[model samples]
Target: MYCYVSEVKLVSLPPILCVHLKRFRNDDGFTKKLYDKVTFPETFSTAIFAAGQSENADCLKADEHYSLYAVVVHMGSTMSGHYTAFISSNQDWYYADDSCVQPSTWEKVQGTYGGYRQRSGETAYLLLYRKKSWNSSG
Candidate 1:
């Protein structure tokens, strides 16, 4: 009989959190990229991951939250790809692809969630979130 236990906890929270998604994998000596739709919320709560005695545990108990502010999107396969970014500024959204920048919408941002097929247009590679102020209304 074998028993395995895994434990993880957060010791502290930072003002800014960056999340990287694993979109590539090596199989049988071949590197391939995966196009999978991963849904993320505009606002995320970290309270569930807080350790009991972690720094600022009180903030977690009080429902401290983070808001998504930016996303890095990757297009193409593992061999080569192009990168773009969707950024939120003062409640406005913009898409930046190389030297081109244009105003965008939340709907457009959501489109980067990727698809369930190989070579699917764009996929979110990185996500950036900022901790909401304690006094923030939302």
Candidate 2:
């Protein structure tokens, strides 16, 4: 016997995509942080995530790709933590931590992937992706 798994698909995509990950769990009467490793690419197509996407719709084009542009990272535990942001634009990445802002790299952003011994208390909680625009005049 085989079991079928049902998956929810996106019917329409927005110009901007914001993804949020649940990094907290409640056990009994206490809450704890989860450090699961969740990796994502810089760019991806939304067609695979869509159900019965119209082939002729410009918005449904398989060539359409979204690029990761920003991330909101949370550091420390649920009781005491700090928030920071990593932003990418003009081919440059920057890290904003309170009053400090400096240049960063994709490698640094990848560090947000929480797991054992990998930036333990620091993790990405939110992500922002923007769809690429294509010129029709060609």
Candidate 3:
């Protein structure tokens, strides 16, 4: 069962929509990363990964994971060993300034390895389309 938050007109309020993201699970004993089932929307047909990695990866890189490279649609799946970045970070993590909170306009901020590494040039991207929770104040 897949559910999505109401898709408002890009500039509308950011509905309390369900952001479901998936990732590979590994118990290497050295380091482990996992995330909630609901995080980022799986709307992007594009994927991020290592350009030269031709084999398979159901794993997370230490903080060294820099950018998010595009991967073929066929390769961005469970059996393929590719997953969303939120999986490794446990969804409760994100990069914040002195305040420790992502600014508005951030299009559903997500971090690789839980903000230890960034997928967007190690920077947060503005989700210009996403609006904050609306208010019905009179």
Give candidate 3 misplaced runs (Cα > 4 Å): 1-28, 35-95, 99-103, 106-138
TM-score of predicted model 2? 0.83
* Residue 88, candidate 2: alpha-carbon lDDT: 94
Which 10 successive residues of model 1 have the least lDDT summed?
Answer: 53-62
Give one digit per residue, the lDDT tens place, for model 1 in 1-138: 999999655555788899999989999999988787888877767655654555644434436788889999998888898999999987788999999999999888888887775355699999999988667853
lDDT of 3 at 101: 43
Q: Candidate 1, which segments miss by more than 4 Å at Cα?
A: 50-62, 117-120
Candidate 3: clashing residue pairs, number: 6
Candidate 3 lDDT by residue in tens digits, 7-122: 22221122222322233355564333333222333222112332333334443221221212111111122333322221112223233333344322223343322333333322
Which number leads on TM-score? Answer: 1
Better of 1 and 3 by lDDT: 1
Q: Across residues 7-104, which tens digit of lDDT does each residue of candidate 2 receive? A: 55444678889999898999998999999998988777765565376665444456567889999999999899999999997868999999999999
CA RMSD of each candidate after superposition:
3.2, 3.7, 18.3
Residue 5's C-alpha lDDT in candidate 3?
84
